[model samples]
Structure formats: structure tokens, C-alpha cells
Target: MSDIIDIASKEVGYKASSGNKTKYSAWYGMNGAAWCHMFASWCANQADVSTSVVPKTASTTTGMQWFRDKGRFKTKGSYTPKRNDFVYFKSDGASHVGIVEYVSGSTLHTIEGNTSDAVKKRTYPLSYHTITGYGVVSDYITSSGDNSKGKNAKNNKGKEELNYLKKILDKNTDKKKKSKRKVKYKISKIRPGINLSVKVIVAHGTAKYKYQVQEGMKFSDERKGAPGKLTFTTFADNKRKITNGDAVAVIVNKRKFFYGFIFSFSPKTDGTLEVTAYDQLRYFKNKDTYISVNKTSTALLKKIAKDFKLKCGKLANTKYPVSRIDDNATLFDIVQNSLDETLIARGKIYTLYDDYGNLRLREPWKVNVLISGQTAESYDYKESIEDQVYNQIKLAYDNSKKGTQEVFVVKNSKSINQWGVLQYYDKVDSKKDIKLKLKSLLDIYCKSGKTLKFNNCFGDARVRAGCLVPVTIKIYDQKVSGYLLVDKVTHTFNNSQHLMDLELSGGDFDSSY
Candidate 1:
């Protein structure tokens, strides 16, 4: 007999080739519909079992109904879920379903599909309130952890006994020897205009550097994409000296060139030098300029790119009508503030970054790669539902000459019912700006119900900041499977392993039932 859990486990890292479209697309007869139930159906098909073994359906509720019709459905609290059994949940409605992988004490390990955009395994306690019921497969018995069959069983036992004795006698301690080599790094290349190259040497054994870039800003700050330090050991015979504002580029995680510039450099105690640098955006942040004008958001973005000698990347198409703005802002300030106004007025999200010294503004939408339970060696997940969420938003703009303040309101009553009237308020100078701004605000805040902090996982090399990715986690006793935005990503490669530390956040998705 084929074990369904065993088969499902083999497919742990399987994912959709494109957005929400998987190999099971044809089986479910839908291109991008939620396929958690369909995944279970496909697993059943793999076992070559009749529907009597596990009723096949694409709807989570429908699957539960089918089990009820068979007189096989039992509520979770009343009946303990066993390995290979189907389980369902109810949230805002019937939210999600999955197959129980195994039960360990009060915890249930499950193999689920359509979680965080791929098939994944999750853990939940028996007391998780969202569980609806468990559908038992009448004819399928759980595996006993024994693979031996027929006359081979006795032979396998004899071999195990012999192996145990041999292991005891041959034990010479399997501890691996630790290497004592000094860790160091080398620069493979520098950008074309940087104009200097020299042998790299560090004064401190473990030099520290950090960089951060955020979604809403033209130039990164100390908090995001801020530059750390680059120290070099100097010699009196050496003719070249690394100076402030010189461009430095190095490979991170063997992924791509992390380009930055020297902010400051100084001689250290023993005659060596320590150079501190910031991201390329630091140039814009430190440089000062002023301009007073009436311009569309796109025009302003293009201007900032031109002034900073950056190639303009993806520009949002919305020609936001902004007028009569003060010019007392820095180059980076204008870029960030204007971008914010545009997003609020246009109802879209954009990211600004120094792409290899080229300034680019792009919407974060592309699904570069998949991160699944099997692919991740280890991971840390932290989610937040902060003041960032809103079920209702009120936008007020004053038409000064007209002697009236026009107020536009947007509300998701269904969300309010669940989250209550978490209201937000904003004021503007233009009445024509209220509806569009409120539309964008509601779209951003209402949808982004939760944010995530993911760390220490091996991710696809293509994964980067501003990309869309799906994630699966159990929160508050429910399986929260949904897509998220990779706001910030740090890649580190050591000991032949690539580890990705991610700051992921996303907008509203219906919780799995």
C-alpha cells in the first residue's frame, strides 16, 4: 500500500512555475485558484486509491461535506487527528484545509498546499481554535515506521542487530576537526567610474559593515541601507590611500555587487586606516539643493534621477496632479516626499534604490523564486498586526478659497466587523486629491494586515528587496498562508551555505480556514 504522507513529503519543495499556477493547474481545472484541497486530491490520485479512500474535491468546505456524507468526519476536539487524515478550518468563513502529516503529543504536523505560495509543512497545537474537523480515511492505516515486508522482515532485523554491534566496537568518535584558518575577503571588482583598485587588507580581524534601503525613500537612512565600515591595513611603502567618497564594490553571498562609497577615513592606532562608507544614496542625502515648481510626480522623479546621474528605472504611470509645493527640501527629501505624495494620490507602491549606482523606481511585484519548507535549512518567523492596519480611513482636504473642507471616506465594513473600527485620518490642501489618496491608503493599510520578519533561511538567489514571495506560518492557532513583500534582504554565504535574512511584509489576504 502506498503511504499518502510519504508521497506528500517527497513533494515538499514543489512550487508553481508562475504566479499561483502549478503543475496541478490542469487537475483542478483552474489556472490560479487556491489549490490546497486540490493538492490533497492530487496526493490521493498518486496513491492510485479510489475516492472511497479519500474523497476528492477542490473546495475546502466541499471536502468536509463529502466526509460528512461518508459518515467519516469528526470534529477535532472530539476525535484526535491521525497521520494522513484530512483536516479543515473555519475563519472569516471556511478558510483552509490540509492533510495531517503526523501527530506528536498535543501538536499536529501537517503537509499543506497553497501556503505562502507553495506546498509546505506546518505545526499546530491541538487547542488551535480554528480547526473545524478531521476526515479519517477508513481503509488507510498509518505507517508503523517499519519498511520490511514479507520474509525480508526477519532478515532486516538480523542485519540491524549486526550493525548495532559493529557500531559499538568501531566507535572512534565521529567529531569533526575544526579548522583554524584566518577569515578574510577580497574585492573581485569595482564599478567603472570608481577609478582606484588596490590590494585589500583589513586591520581588524572581523570588520563590520551594514547597509539598509527602504521602500518609501529615495535615499536610504542609517536605519535602512546605511553604510557601516571598511578598514584596511596600510603600509608606508604603499603609494595609494583610500580616500573619502571613493566608490567601493564587493560581492555579498556571491549574489551581486554591493556598491557603496567612503563617507570617512582615518588612521587607526597602529598606523592602519579605517574607512567608513554609506550607500550610494548618501551622496544625495548629504548634497543640498532647492527648487520650487509645479510638477507631476513622474516629472519630479525623472528630475531627481537626472540630477544624481542615475538611470531612471521603472516609473509609475500615474501623473499625479500636485501643485505649488515649497522648494526648501534636499534632493533626497524631494524624492522621498514626492514619491510618498504620488503613492498616496495614485494608490500604488513603489521602491526607490541605487541599482548599481543607477537610481531606479520600481513597483515590487515580480515573484522571483519560491522558499519552501524543504529548501529552508532553518528559519525564524515573526509577524505583527500593528497600528499599520486600518479598516476605515478618512481623508480631508481643504479648498481654501472655496471656504470648505471636503472629506472623503473609505471603509471596509467586513474588516471592521472583525478588527473593529481601526480608523485613520489625514488632511490635505487639495479636495481633488481626497478620493484617490484614500483609495490608495485603504488599499495599502487595510490589505497589509500583517508584517513578517523572516531570517536564516536558504532562499533562491533571485530573491531580493521589493520582490513578492509567499510565506506559511501558524499564528494564533491558525495556518496563515499568504504572499508577502521582501522589504529588505541580507544574504550571507559561509561554509558552502547561502543564508538569507529577510524582512518580509504584505497586505490583506483571506486567512486559510
Candidate 2:
């Protein structure tokens, strides 16, 4: 393992050095470069154990594809990444690469080189979202299949042999112990938002050793759900055997524990026999919980607001004298009662005028009913006053005809209370003059609309209709002024007379009109 580590480290250093000289100059010049990719390459190189130089590349996507195409990458997503395999990143392009140090859960914690900084080891979450793919580069051998070539090879091979010798020495030293045993185990970090399976190994001289898994807790008291006895058997060699799919007890220790789960194995490694246990667990963090709440709240609010707005046409501004309010009162009961009483109320209409005192011709008023008492004390009506006034103006323009056209329920006011003023003029005879005049009027109205301040009521003018002469309407103090520009050659006025007639004949406009 030591020899492998050294070789891997050297290979990573080489890659980092090369990358720094070329594409990673910025990183190398910094305090320290990132090591995510370099470490990965080094581990892969060392694991190969062969004399051939492992193929290295700059492209992350291409490198992963290369391995996959060769049938070297693992099929199952859970498989731990071994040394000497390609590490990939889902970046802007196939640009990042690294080697695997170890695989835990769905992520690969690796020591990679060639990052934003110089070569260094970093752990990254492993998933399709981050990793485009990965591939194996080499096994426990040199690429050339030659173990006896250069000085570096000889030195590395000698070190490897020595490490093997050390392992044998350790095994022999343990053999002298008559009560020890060996156990196989796998360790992994618990990941957020996922259930993890853990395998633990225990070994040697156990007098019915008890065990307990707790999240950041001490292994002291069984009464507190601490170290409890595990069920298992002693083998012929006096070794206790445990495998996957075993039930385990998890306990709690200290107050305010942040760690997910913790457990202890007793009778440390014995040369002869071992005990093992496996468990699956999960963790939930704060961010996930918050996101769920936010999404749900936003959706609900949008739905309610949309329905209310559709019924009200536009929200009225309290700053406008044209008072309008919406009531949250249940409409079902009201509609039923109105129908039974045969009570039909007529809608009020008013013409709208622009700041220039011209009657708006194109844009028509839209009628909306206020159910009563739905207004909130804090609601700002000024924000939507323009829309409400425009709707009322549109209603009045549609009612204009040759005779006196009356719209019902016109709210009594201090100015122009009896009826609205509808003025007509032939302006299309001079197209250029009309256009210039219209532009000048619009500029002034827009400026006034921005400058005027009204606490409860305000008004402005806007050009909402006509192709030739154009009509400009001003809405002020709940009264509308409509200006119609007639085309002298066509002998036609730009207005909604036809619409008003239809409404009158069909009783579409309130019968009170």
C-alpha cells in the first residue's frame, strides 16, 4: 500500500507539473493549485503496478468515453472506484478530469490534481449530475508487461516487494497470538439525502463482545442503548463470522449531536478469526426541508392571486377617486340570493380623458363587480389605478352614439357628474400634423404620469385608439374625456359606436342606461 501510494503521488505530481506548464498556468502561479484530477491519475497509475506509462489526457469527457468504450468502467453505480480509473466532471464541456481515491455512497472522495489551484486532493460528490462518466486505466501492472526496465521501475518494484514483505511480517507477528483473528470490512461516509449500507469487521479474543451504533455517541452504557451484544457464531478456528444483511442496533450518546451514525468494533484485529456487521441508514438536512416549503407556498399564492385578478380585471389604486374594492365574500350564496330576488344591478360607465383633455378612442373600458368587503387594510390601490380607470373609459367609449348615450350607475362627483364629454374633430386631413401633435401629447402625459403624486386619487391621459387621426383620453377624478379624430375623406369617426349599438339592442349594457 505504501509503495502504491508513493507511485500514485509521483504520477499525480508529474501530471500537475505538466498541466501547470501548459493549460493550468494560472493555478500553478497561485498559492496552491487544485489536486482533484492529479490525485485521481496518480492512484490509477499506482494501481496499475505495471511498467508502462498510463495514458493521460486533458479532456474529461473523452477520457471517460475512452474507458466506457473499452468496457472497463463499472456498470453498477454503487461500485467503489478503484485506483487507476478515470474521473470525469460535467462541466461546460468535457473539461475536468481526476483520479479516484475511494468511492463512498454515490460520490467519489478523490485526491485529484489540476484544479483551480495547484495539484491537491479534494473530495467531490459522485453522481450523474456532476460526473459525466468514468473509466479504468490500468490494473496492478505496468502497461508494457515488463517489470525490469528502468531505474525508476527497479526502485518502485523493490519498494512494492518490501511492502509485501512487511505485510507478511505483520501477519507472522500476529500468528504468534493464539487468540486473534482476521476480519474483512468496508467503511464508507454517510451521505446526505441517501440511505447508506455499512459493513463493520471485528476480530479476536471476544468474551461475548457487545456493540452499538450511535450518531456521535460514546459506547459506554447498554441501558442508554449503548454497546449491546450481537448474535453470531465462532468458527472452527475460533473466528466469529458475520456477513452482509445483518441487523444492528444504533444508539444515541451526547446531546445536540450533528453526526449521523456511530458504532464501535471490539477486540481489535486478531490474526485468526473476525466478526462483522452491516447496516443501512439515512440522513436529512435543513436545505432540503426549506426548499420543499418554499415551492409549495409560492405555488399556492400564485393560484389564488390569478383567480382574484381575473375577476377584478385590474386592481384599483386608492390614489384614484374612482373607488373600487374586491370582497372575499363567498360568491355562491350571493349569486343564489340575487337570482331569487330578481335583483339585477346595472354597471356604471364613464369616459376617460388624457392629460391633454383628448377623449381616448381605441382602448375601451372593462366592467368588474366588487363583491364587497374583501379589501385588505394594507392594500395599495394606487399601483393598479391606471388599469381600473382604463377599463371604465373603455366601457364609456363603447356606448357613444348619434343620440344621447347613457350608461348606468355613473357615480355622482364634483366635476362632470351628469355625463361625460365626447368631442370629435377631423385631423387625418393633415397626417404629419396629427402625428406630431400626438407624439407631443404622449410625451407630456407620460412625464406627468410619473411626476404626479396622489395619496387616494390621481389621473392621466393616454392614446388608446385610432389609425389616422387617433383618439386621446384623459381620466381624472372618476370622469373620462373622450376625443375622437374623424377622417374627413372617409366621413367616419374612430369610435366604438357599433359596439354600443349592439349592447343597447341586446340589453348587454345595463338596462338602466
Candidate 3:
């Protein structure tokens, strides 16, 4: 809350030693630069609001842009000032920034750095024309305590955020120790990136006229938070009813696969048309700042869709409340981060996709589709102790009173011997249960990661990313069977053939359909 004001106030009487050198400028990597924004950034950091409520920057312009991007910026004279909010001033552009200390009706009291070679208390009229704008800092609620109008919240919000951070520190922990029901299917071998396109390109180079407009159409629907992209080749004889910005649908055998607007179409050297279309999810690529208070992920999505004038459909109720500031984030990243919070806190995965032209948010998709190797294909199955697999959990807490660092550790001797002491380390607040938390983290991170991919499976129109499909395959004398979330899927279609390649995640299988 008002902690920023208090911290900045303490520095008000401190003068730069010389050569524009100050503690703030030194920490910001520009020891000799003007330090007003750096001073504000340092104060916000000490207040634990930097980048969460205020931007961390050395340039006042960048900080102003951050507020504007988050829609938290108010032009000068247009807004009533509040504690911890930023006051930016400009001659030509934003040249200086300060922390608001108090507002008395139309008069403003502030603290600024790099002014007259020292930090000092400042006063100005609220309608000062030189004042460019104000960056709103909404998290601090100092109005509740001592009427100081500065400081942190004295409410349950702190506890909730603390718990949220704890959950993030222990993101790998699963309440249930059991894996879901397994599904066995044959698989296909795969390589990295554009498996289908690689083959078509190789074939075209050697076989000539392979995979041209005669191949019909290909559909590629990406997972949650990603725009659905459709790429197809067709002859002009098929009628050029589709144009840029026109709604385009891809259907084969009476099964509608992709519904989106054609963004671009070009003629290939082979006298065939190459077209690309993207679903409504494409719009979420827009970046903006969003502030939510006690709103569920689904509810927030609805609000965002409405605010952007996008269509929405079939949004599942995600009851976990998200109350935080996502400043200057892409809409896709905003939605994904919100869903990820639920995934970490409540162990639930949700999907946001475009159904036809309508934006849809759904719970983890589970279905009865079976993956099989009857199409004369195999798969690449890998389980390795590399990457995020840890056998030991070590947490440290600084003890200022004792002048020493306290260490807590939980380790599996067998895993340590086998995996060679892979450790997950972080600093925890003194209030945390070191032993219990470490044990939970050890259980979560001490396992090998299993990755499954198929490159030559027969295309099924029903298969798409973000959906759980039962997959069964054997690896190293172990029959791995479970519902796998399709991380990405690429489908290709020709006159006589349709094939898909899938990269799936083999953990936390959702049995709910």
C-alpha cells in the first residue's frame, strides 16, 4: 500500500554523493544516469509492487507506457490522486516521474528524485499542465490503517497471495498419488517441428507434383491460448469464394474441421492457391493490462471477450477466484496464466478455444477417442531424468537475527544415488513448514519425465489439441497407458490420404470428459 510513499519519503533528504551516483541509479545498472524513475522503481520494489502494480524501469517514458498499456494511466488533471500512485511529468515527452504522497483536493504532495541533486518533497497543483499523467497503483490500501493513505493491505488478501506463492513454489505437488486409467494404442515415429510439412516438402522435391492443389485441404487446430491456423492448397477451379477477411470453413466427409476467416491467400508456382485462415482466438494476441478482483477464470474470459467485442460460447464455470494484476500482458498470455493459477492451486486444467467463430472456454477436455497403430505407424516414447526432475528439495530462509542462513532439505537417497542429486532450491518465508513442504516437493519432482509423440497417425477430424485422448504404447518393457493431453496437433489432407502428427503431455491426465 503506502509502503512506497514511506520508503520514498525516507530518501527525500538524501543527496547524490557526486557524478549523479545514487543508490537507486547504481542498482538500476546506470550509476551515472538520472535516477527519478529508478528511484520510483526502487521504492516500488521495496514496497513489493514493482511490475505487479508499477513498472520497474530506468526510463520514465517506459514506465508511463507500462501504465498506459495496463489501462492504469490517467492523463493529468483527469484523475484524483492516491497514495503509491505515480505522477509523471513531461516537457516534450515524459521526462520525470515521482511517487504521490498525498492529495488535498486540488493540491498534490509528492516525492521526487534527481531533483536539485537530491530527493525532496514536492508540491504542485492537481491540474498542472506539465504533469503528463498518473499511473494508478490499486493494490495498496493504506486508507484502512491510521488514515496514513500509505502502506500494505491489512486484510486477507496478503494471506491469499502468500498461499498462492506457496502453491507456485510447490507447483509439481499432486494431491492424488494415483495415475488415471490407462489407454493402450499403437504409435508413430516423429521428429521435431512441422512433421507433416517436412514430409510433403521432401516428397515434392523428389516425386514432383506431390502434395499440390490436388491434395485437397489440410487443417491445423492449435491448443488452448493458441490461434487455430488452417493451411490448404486448392485449384482456382474450386471457385474463389473465399477472400481475405471472409469467413472460411474447411469440411471433408461432412466433418467440419476448421472455421475461421481467411487472412491471406497466394498463388503457388504450381498454379495452385495457398490459403491461411485463423480462428477467433487469433484476436487474443492483442496485449493489454487487466486487473481482476475475485473473478474466476471463466468469468474473466467473458469480461475480456465482451470488452474486445469478441463472440463467446460454452464457457465452463471455473470457480477458483483470481485476484491479481496482470500488467501489460497479451490476452492469450493473460488467459493462460489465469488458467495456470487454477491448475496449480486446484489441480484443474481448462481450455480456451474458438468453436466455429465463437470463443469457448472449457474444462480439461476428455473424450473416448482411441489412438491406435493400425495405420502402419510407430511412436517415439522418451522418459528421462533430465529437465525439472529433482530428487532433492532444499529451501533456505535468511535469519537476520542469527546472522546466518537456515537451510532445510528433503531428499530421496535412492533417487539421489540414481539421479545424481538433482535439487530444486528456493527461498521460503520463515512461516512455511520446511519439512512438510520439502517432502511434498520431493514427491512431486523426483520422477522422470515421459514424452510421447506420433508422426504418422491416420487423421481423425475429432482430434485436436487441449483435448485428452487415450493413448497406449509400450516403452522399455513398460506398457504406458493413460489419457494424454494433446499439446499440439498438425493435420494434413490429400486427395486420397489424411494424416496427423501429435505431441502429447503424459502427466496429470484428466479423466473428466
Candidate 4:
């Protein structure tokens, strides 16, 4: 466990790289926004705090409300700010937040973001007028005591080395390779009897919004789609109107870009339509349903899809009994929860999307592309120990027939020695087949001792999220190459360049795995 202060101190001098956007924005899914609250959330996330302890948000008011709701908040003058607590204040009639560094006498020191557009330490008197309250985060703080002093010194050394390496790479312009591919994007409206394409202005989507892997790719409680917008012109007559709930498609470079549907559309005076679209799952979002079953998890899911007239594919055969489950949730809720356990146990994932009005559920596809200096414009590499790589997992499940809870444990002793015992727990039915499944999962994910994230920008319009791509890049004055599984991808198109921001994980090139 890492101390909260230690995690935050490492990023004290952080600043926005462009506009109001800092790398910390990625942590809260809000770029180009005031980031004081985001900085605090990022620190909590790095400390591995549960959502119940610290609800994730970028808005200052939302963060303060979460702390207050949890009874961890006290009025500013009512309590002295402690180390690792969140301090909320009103600046210019707007709320802002920061993480408390320490308290000395009546002076409260804090680490805040968006303060003069950079992260820096600031001090204030306990009775400052702008102060609102303090959120106690001491319960979530894990300490190494004086041992953290040594770790901080070692981290500073790593930063110095990284800075020196960056200088060397910046001077090596000869390594850059020129690309010959052209960039283009177009939006298409596909209905029962027509297909139309138009020039697109801008397109953007974040996996954190609607395509979240952990949340079963469903939109937020207050939203309906993965949240996407398109600006385009319709040259045809106003006969066929592209209205809400209409199935639409986006194409770039003569390829099927996204299979989605129109959420809302507005026509402009210049004969253009600003259409908002989401993934195909938006079509069945409001279908309320009920199920009371004593069936296998897979069987129950298939039955739900069939009753709803939905098409499902690539159903892997892993029979696990899920009995006496009664719920009044939607069809999506049932299907998503049925497979949630498998996802956590083995990293297995499934998606449901409409393929041109045909709803389909199946495992996502992988694309293997060899990205090098010639095909990529810019690339960056990041590795962090906070990713929580597990080499051992303990599974506990209730055996109603046996009247006891059975345990299944799997471990890699070599990994435990090298990286320590990173542990995980899962609730699964006690079956020999399920235990075998857990063992196979540990063997695959336990090989890597650290988490490596690769960010690459290239001109490939075919690259999409969930695709497996091989990367070969030189960083830290050394060549780091590996095949990474793409977690999220963003396609940015413009007149000068077509760029893709890809977040990739898994697979290590520096180790013997």
C-alpha cells in the first residue's frame, strides 16, 4: 500500500500540457476543465481507495457532497485540516478542491491543481473566508512511516533519469519516419431503404463515458448513450428526415467506423445536421423486464436474449449454476450481470451492438497491426506499480448443498518472490470446472510484474478499441517493443493530420514472461 501524501508529492509540479488539460484529466474523464478536484481524485485512485471511500468525480461540488454524505466532512473552522484530507473552498463564487498536505500550528498546507494553471503547494490560515470544509481521508491512508522518506528520494532519482532520457530523445529527430497515408472521415445515415454519406466536422468518444469495460459498456444512470456527436451536411431533399432513434453509421476511409444510432438531430440553416449518436445498445435501453430463474448463468442469459428477440453470438460454454435469482431489472441488466463474474475471474468480456438493425452479442475482435516509426506520428510509454498486478488469487464460494463455503487458491511462487503477493478475491460457485477456470486465468495474467501503458498516434483508420496491436518504440534511450491489448482508442481527424490516441495494456517486452 502507498501513502496518499507520497503519491501526491510525486506530482507536485505537474501542469497542464495543453489548454486547461493536464494528464491528470485522464484520471477523472474530464479534459480542459479546472482540475483541483481531479487532482485529489487522482491521488485517491492511486492509493487504491474503494469507490465507497471516495466517489470518483471531476466536479468540486459533487466531490464535496460525496464526502459530506459519507459523514467524513466537517466545517472549515470546526476542524483542523489533517494530512491526506480534501479541502473544499469557493473561489469566485465557484467551488474548488485540493488535497491537504499537512497542518502546522494554524497554517494548513495543501497541494492544489489549476492554481495559476499548475499543481503547487499553498498555505492558508485555518479561518480563511473562502474555505468551506475538510474531507477526512485518513481512513484510506496507508503509511510506510519513515520508509516513505527513502522511497521519495528514490523516486526523485528516477525522475532525474527520465528527464535526461527525454533530452536525448528530443534531439534524435532522425528517428522520425514520414507517412504517405491520406486522412478522411464521413458520416452516413442508414435506414430501411436509404444510405447517405456526408462530410463530417468533428467526432469524439471516450471509453470512460459509455464504453466502460467494467460497467458493462452501459451509459451512466442519467444518460442514454456512449455520448457521441457528428456535424455533417445533407445534400438531398428534406423528404427523409434523420430523427432520433434512427440507426446511423460513421465511415472513414471507406471502412465501417462505428455501428450506432442517432439520439437527437438538429438542422442548421446551411443544410447541415448536428446529429448525436450512441452505440447500438441504445435501442433497448428502456425495455423494462423481469426474470425469476434457477438456471445456469449462460442459459439464463441466452433465454433473456431470445425472449427479447436479440441476436447473440460467440457464447463460450462454461456452465456454472446460478440458482434462485429473482430480479425486476432490464434485459441488459440481466445479461451484463450474468457475465460480470466471468470477466473478473478471467478478463473475459462481451459486447452487445446492433449490426445495421441486427442486435448481436459476442466477444470483441482483435486487430494485429505492426506499428513502427514509419506508420506512427508520435508515441509515449508509461509504466506504474500502482496497477495492482496479481500473481495469486483466492476464490471463495458458498456451497449450499454442502452447507459450507469452499475455497480455491492459485499462485505462482516465482511471481510472488519477484513482485510480492498481489492478491484478488472472487465469489464463484464451488465447482471443479470453475476452480480449473480460475487456475487458467491466474496463469495468463500473473506473468507481468508491472503495468505498462503505451500511447501511440498513427494514421490508421482501421485501428479500434479492443484490437491487439504490436508496438516497437524507443523510450528512455532503449527500444521497448511488445504486443499490447488496446483498452481505449480516440480518432481525431483534421485537414493536416489524422491521429488516433490509443491506450494499451498487458504484454511486457522488458521481462522474461
How accurate locally, in lDDT, is each candidate?
0.55, 0.28, 0.68, 0.54
- What does candidate 1's lDDT look like per residue over 283-364, in tens digits? 5554333332557666776766677675655666546654322222345555554555454445456666655545555676
Ranking by lDDT: 3, 1, 4, 2
Q: Which stretches of candidate 3 lie over 4 Å from their true place?
A: 1-177, 180-213, 237-241, 372-376, 508-513
- Among the numbered candidates, top lDDT falls to 3
**Positional deviation of residue 210's Cα in model 4 after best superposition, in angstroms:** 28
RMSD of 1: 29.3
**TM-score, one value per model:** 0.42, 0.23, 0.65, 0.41
- Where is model 2 more than 4 Å wrong at Cα? 1-5, 8-19, 22-53, 75-78, 91-94, 105-107, 137-513
Indicate the residue-level lDDT of 411 in model 2.
21
Candidate 3 Cα lDDT to native: 0.68
Using TM-score, give the best candidate's number.
Answer: 3
In candidate 2 the C-alpha lDDT for residue 161 amounts to 28
Question: Which run of 10 residues does model 1 get worst, by summed lDDT?
Answer: 148-157
| TM-score quality measure for candidate 1 | 0.42
Cα RMSD to native, each candidate?
29.3, 38.0, 11.0, 20.3
Candidate 1 Cα outliers beyond 4 Å, as residue runs: 1-240, 252-256, 265-275, 287-294, 308-318, 324-326, 372-449, 459-462, 473-476, 480-482, 493-497, 509-513
The digit string of per-residue lDDT tens for model 2 on 1-513 reads 112333544544344344345333332233234444434434433443321123333345545655564345554353334443556675545467765544444455544565554555567665555565555542422222111111122223323323333443444345346223332223122122233222222322232223322222211101111111222222322333433333333211112101112233233343322233321111100011011111222232233334433111222111211111111212222111122111111121221111111111122332121111111111111212121011111011112244433322222132223233221111121122233333322221221111111111110111111111111112244211121221111111111110000001001011111
Runs of candidate 4 with Cα error greater than 4 angstroms are 1-240, 251-255, 268-271, 284-333, 344-357, 386-456, 459-462, 477-480, 493-498, 508-513
- Give me candidate 4's TM-score against the actual structure: 0.41
What are the per-model numbers of colliding residue pairs? 13, 67, 13, 0
